[model samples]
Target: MLGSSDPQNARPASLDAIDLSMLAELERNGRLTNAALAARVGIAESTCTQRLRSLRDRGVIRGFRADIDPAALGLTLQALITVRLGTHGREQIRGFEQRVRSLPSVLTAFHVAGADDYLLHVAVESAAALRELVLEHLTTHPHVRHVETQLVFEVLEGSGMVPREPVHPPHV
Candidate 1:
């Protein structure tokens, strides 16, 4: 709820470009202290703290998180599986989504608007394990009409879309 979506009700007049700059710095390095963030964004430490509080109040600043490495955690194999459902109705889509989400290997499932109605990002131990995942999980589902898997030979980037960058403050 970072400021209301309603344009008229959004950020207060006192909140300006400097506050936004603080937010941007936090986005790049979530673990940065208020003092550190203040220095980087060239604001007073107390002002940085207050601005951060305002951002939090508005719901702009969500909880901080550590980025976990899946590969290091022994999740080696990753693939993108495009699933074509037998029917594209809303109920069917919801049912399929719930079931697909329940699978252990299915990291993310996106209902796309192209040739495939659903795109699944999965990670497993090996190629054989991937085949088993496709067989035991995806194909067995009732609404699943066609399942196409593109084995990720090498990951230029690992599974799932990177989050969009936080909007930067406009130049003064």
Candidate 2:
């Protein structure tokens, strides 16, 4: 618990060593209890709690979620579907995003800048379901000009961390 007079309540210009350690530990396991995390980081439980609260308030710690296995949930097949839009209007983009997000098969969708307008990460049970999704739902839509799908053989997921500063080689 952070007291009213505590200096830590003030927003830090940059994260300190302890803050980085906390983030690294949390990235490894989001469900760690305050007491457990404190022990791991070699800090007091109250300080750990205050640091976590500060991180969350500053939007550094976005949100915690359970890492679910899609395969275990009967969504074994995965594909990256590239969609080219007929128009890149605001209304059209919003409509396409809304419709694509509505589909249960679509795990994530990105409105990207590349050869394609949108990239969709989809998971389904079988090839038949994938075909139906592509044909009946995507291609049939008025906004969708062209759709291409590439089957994913394997997916290697990460903690989604981006370093703020460039790393240089250590001097010998």
Candidate 3:
């Protein structure tokens, strides 16, 4: 919760230009073959494998996932729901986080700064479903004091985006 997305507890790892290039290429195409990646990075296949393993071990490459469209899945509605908690106790915060993680409609949840405590990216089949999600999973919680929802008109994909420089991930 200290940062937007912090690294897991992992050893400190430095990145060279080659590593950065591999990361950029992977960011563009996570499903690339090892040989393709090696060729793109101008490195041997064995070296690419080792480098990828090292990146994963160091918590650089978190995971590869499909970017599913909600509309294609019959979930035509998307929303950004902001939530504010009445209390900030450690147990309450932990409890709230655990509770939010269990919800299926939540695409992503951010324990954030500013006026709200959390911002939830959710997708649902209809407006009624969105209401149900908020009532059942969010406002019903004892600590949640306020909830606001905004409908999403569109979402542009940029999952492959990454900085050219190898930024150090803060150890969690």
Candidate 4:
């Protein structure tokens, strides 16, 4: 599920050195069976299950997702849009998130601190789509003050770059 939580999914303990071995094993292959994970962690399968559950419940383990290629989906254009807000208020942020989330081309939306108040990762089929997304949809939103976008030239996928398990960092 995209946003489901179970009490059993909680972290064991972060203070105690995370089983580096377990992490390394998971890093190598996220889909390792529970039995295999237990064996790699040198613990009983039940113990492994309990620890994994605890890790999940404590918000350590988030969820699993597949990384797909956008180009394969006919979305060849990728752009990063920097958005400036007309006003800094809780309501404005919520409005921005609501509008941004409704757009199909937005892959990710981030509220950042600095020159821009928000950053959006968008993928589209063509320059026209990009223009519609930035000029028509994003800029015209009620809370949006100014917007700037840059095309992406490359994307990287590899080890140490992607997380094996799911984790949601606290949203500001």
**Winning model by TM-score:** 3
Error of 3 at 165 (Å): 10
Scored by lDDT, model 4 comes in at 0.78
Q: How accurate is candidate 1 locally (lDDT)?
A: 0.79
lDDT of 4 at 58: 52
The global C-alpha lDDT for each of the candidates, from Candidate 1 onward, is 0.79, 0.86, 0.88, 0.78
Model 1, 47-160: lDDT tens digits are 888888877776666568886655776779889999999987889888988988789888778878888888988888888989999998889989999999997777564422
List the candidate numbers ranked by lDDT, top first. Answer: 3, 2, 1, 4
Clashes counted in candidate 2 amount to: 0
Alpha carbon lDDT of residue 56, candidate 4?
64
Off by over 4 Å in 2: 1-13, 159-168
Best by lDDT: 3
| Tens-place lDDT digits, model 3, residues 85-167 | 99999999999999989998999999899999999999999999999999888999999999999999998776565575657
Q: Point out the worst 10-residue segment of candidate 1 by lDDT.
A: 157-166
lDDT of 4 by residue, 39-157 (tens): 87789998788877765665555655666789999999999999999888898889888989999999988878798998999999999999988878988888888999899999765
Residue pairs clashing, model 1? 1-58, 2-58
Model 3, runs deviating above 4 Å:
1-12, 159-161, 164-172
> Residue 126 in candidate 3 has what lDDT?
99
Sum up the clashes in candidate 3. Answer: 0
Error of 4 at 10 (Å): 14
Shift of residue 155 alpha carbon in model 2, Å: 0.9
Clashes of each: 2, 0, 0, 14
